[model samples]
Target: GKTQNIYALNYNDKDNDIKISLGLLDTKHNWSGWISPVNGKGTKSDTPNKRWNFNIQKSVDLTNKDEMVFGLQYTKDSMHKTEHNLVNGELNKQSKGNTRSYGLYIQNDHKFDNKWSILSGIRYDNWKVYDSWMQLDKDKSKTIYYPARSDSSFSPKIALQYKIDDESNLFTSWGKAFAAPTLQKMFSGSASSASYTEANPNLNPQTVKTVEIGYKKKFGESTILGVTYYHNDINDLLYTRKTGLGKITYTVNGSTYTKDKQRVENAGTATTNGIELDLNHKINDQWSMFANYMYQQSKIDKCSTNGAAEGKIMTYVPKHVFNLGVDYSAGKWNSELVGSYQSKMYAQDNNSDTAKGVYTAYDPYFVVDFNLTYSMDKNSSISFAVNNLFDKEYYSYNLCEGRNYMLTVDYNF
Candidate 1:
């Protein structure tokens, strides 16, 4: 179960072309479940999170063909978590952490001529993590505190567009970005009867560089086509790996049990290349259709810890994906039908997990869905939807949901 609250304020000055915004969020999530059905053991967890942000931006019109903008942003976030064992009435695990960030950015948009235009931006950000700790109780009680860490990065991006005609254009973009590790990945740990994980405090941030090129065109005022190719180079990717095996002692009884232990780490470097194609067409006033396809190849270039993972395809990334949909509308009725398909994907970094029709297996699947809505009046409507129309059976770590139905009603005053 979860609950959340959000509040926001915005101020706009038309004459100065300035905008200012502030936002706050509070959230609470709790979970309780039986750990073992045979032993009647249970566990409960609680997590609370809070965040606030402020942003200000200003735009300047230098000339009819050129414009510039500048912006500043700041954010603060905090999280706390606690887990307890019901049978023993004792704390099993606990974690708390906070993060802060500051950012500044500048952008310029310019048009050299009627057929050429360019957009460029640069941003600098500083991120800080502090006051992070984790505690775990298994065979014994232990507590670990993470050292404070801070880092700064600069990202830059540029895009150029060439107009072939009024109905078509070509565009290309390149950018570099950075992402810091989440609080859960760096300061959270959990223990159970069969498995456990340890927090990693020395992990580094990940970085990626991307380049993309695309073309879009309109045909006969009823159809549109788009194609794009993109490449990404990533460094310091994070993944969880089995570290070793350890013994866990049950507090209710002094019995000890062996379990697998895992930890998160900066695993390796990776690269991805992909191409996408999409088309949209309008057959008549009451019918429209859309289709899209993507082909991607993602591979791990190097692995510092496991040699088998190098040169293998990344886990959970399918090589091919496709989607098609048709929509119809006539007077007070509207309906849509969509189909999706994906190739098989691996479940392990080494590409060694091959059993199908079982738990923790990845399998190829294709499914179709449909929805229809009838407008009863100007302010009221009802909708019916059917998902997984064919009841396809597949596994994505666990068993996928089969065919399902939903009915929705909407009314407005």
Candidate 2:
């Protein structure tokens, strides 16, 4: 079943990116997202998820062989969802929230003679959730207002490299990473209409400490191979409880009310040990092949729920992933083919979806894609692509898309 509007043309917004590098200064600005038109009557959309980022970097000389880099960055992210009643043309506001982030970082690269080199960097980030509001309506009516919230963190990384002969090299590094809740999670208020779900504003960020070692080698100018083994220790990992309960308060029409709200919490700790391999080879002047594979094992080191989830594997994280691809080029024609595979995956923490005789899991699946392009000149090209070329049946929770084809024409000014 389908419908069509033959007389109208749909216009979609595009991303805006600008970058500059001059002398010792470098800067980048990017803005993109979908915003529901507040006044466009015929268009429909999900919650608007608008984002903006601006960063600037400067290079300074600490010695001639040693260099230091300084950077400053700012970011803004917001989500606003609204819907209009079809019959009466009345507008209703569902959710509104925004967040801002400021960051500063410094790094130094030092070359100690011809055989040894090192890079070290430290970053500080501050995030704030502000100017957020939520209401089913707008007349001093049913609404919940979230309080302003903030979080800050410091992360540091260091790496060293050594020259082995002239064709191969070895490297090792240690780094700290952190993830904080998004504006949607930190500022969403409880919906009075829902009986048992509410939002929390005081959740802690997840953090990981990583250590890695690796070796890489180049065989001539057309071939390269690299491999790495790494481990991560993650704490205060964030997972949604879904049925989490907390108290909420709001006022309407000279009356105040309070109720329990359900949301997510900081609930677990985990560790991952993994190995990755990458290889690329150019068979000749017109043909090349590339492949990569990852073997990862992650376990729940601790669970706050203290039940079936205590020792289970993390959800949706596969133990194996492999990708293989090749490319070809002729006078005016270019072609590529790629194949990818994933091992089995579980969809939930409980791992209990197996109400049947067997535990239901997402089956391992493989997919392949092909593309061909013809160049008309230096400024234009036409491409035809076959995605999911075999139309494999699979599921990552829900059924995946089937085989499809596309043709595109691109031009540059």
Candidate 3:
């Protein structure tokens, strides 16, 4: 016999454009099972991660058919956690991380006619972090810890949209995005893997430039179509290297000196392009169907470190994805069926030595989900849904758990 546990979150938001939100997140996890060579006792782990956020958005009208909008957002986040193994009573760690960010954005919408309109917007963000982690080599013993460092960055986004007619619209836009490296990567001050000899405290943020074009069309009163094409170029990816740790001896209390050489660099660049399409049709008042397709490709344009990913495809990003679903509603009964598929994707960055081979492509797989509902009255209904009907075997984003089915029931009173 075995026991399992769960953790959850609940949030509440109030107000209009300028909003306030609060939430609580907690975990109470325990597992117990009986097996051959291991202790049948259970394991327990308790942790909590929480955050409170506030956002503000407002729009000003410049003309009868034109308006400009602006927004500001802020968040405060914190986490506390620990890990332990029940069989051997191995104590792990209890640490936390926190961050805050603020942003300003503006946009304008103009209408030229019933079938023609244009929209554009620009945004800026300033982000900051506290309690960042870093690894270091102190004394002869290696230790990992957080370093005191405050970093900030400015990023921008721009977009434009044009309407072709009442039934169709075409649009395109370009923007820039950025992400700062984790604190552990910088200050942990120690290296466990052979890829990095030492942590780089001066690591820069990763940057990306994205361009996209899209169109949306409506046919008759029961069908709609949407298509989009996007491309992205990224730069300044962090690269790690190995450095020799030479033999040395020294006295600790009075005179102890050790010597080591660390290797570090920031050499990473890449480009990705993709296309997306979606279609929805209402065959009648009792039946409807929806379909979606996505195709993407990513390649390494530059490499600064010795890794399988250099000059090869980015890890985990698949080249194709698709989904289809149908829904039926008649009188007091309703039902739905949905399916999704994804093409094979690589599991490693380098094209070499992998337990399953360098180009370990996962098999193409699909999942079917179903749902049913019954109306208790004109104002109330009850419903049940089962996700992953066939329980297909697949993984998204490499390290995540594979597929599973879920049964859900909802009631309205």
For each candidate in turn, the TM-score is 0.82, 0.75, 0.70
Poorest stretch of ten by lDDT in candidate 3: 187-196
In model 1, what is the error at residue 336, expressed in angstroms? 4.0
Tens-digit lDDT track for model 1 on 13-76?
A: 9999999999998886645344555687777777788889999999999899989999999999
Q: How does candidate 1 score on lDDT? A: 0.84
Expressed as tens digits, the lDDT of each residue in 1-413 for candidate 2 is 11212221222222322232222111121212222245323312135466666666667778977888887877777766654443344565466777888888989999997889999999898888877776656453777777787888899999999988677999999999877777557544433222334455567778889999999999998899999999999888776553234566743222345754545667778888999999999999999999999999988778785456667777668899999999999999999999999988765566544332232347788999999999999989999999999998776545677899999998765
Q: Which runs in model 3 stand beyond 4 Å of their true positions?
A: 1-20, 28-48, 60-62, 81-95, 112-116, 132-145, 179-205, 238-267, 330-334, 351-363, 373-382, 395-413
Name the runs in model 1 displaced over 4 angstroms.
1-25, 35-39, 51-60, 73-75, 138-141, 190-197, 242-260, 329-335, 369-391, 402-413
Evaluate all candidate structures by whole-model CA lDDT and list the values in order: 0.84, 0.72, 0.61
- What is the lDDT ranking, best to worst? 1, 2, 3
Q: Which of the two candidates, 1 or 2, achieves a greater lDDT against the reference?
A: 1
Q: Is candidate 1 or candidate 3 better by TM-score?
A: 1
Against the hidden true structure, what lDDT does model 2 obtain? 0.72
10 residues in a row with least lDDT, candidate 2: 22-31
Worst 10 residues of 1 by lDDT: 247-256
RMSD of 3: 7.8
| Of 2 and 3, the candidate ranking higher by TM-score | 2
Question: So what's the TM-score on candidate 1?
Answer: 0.82
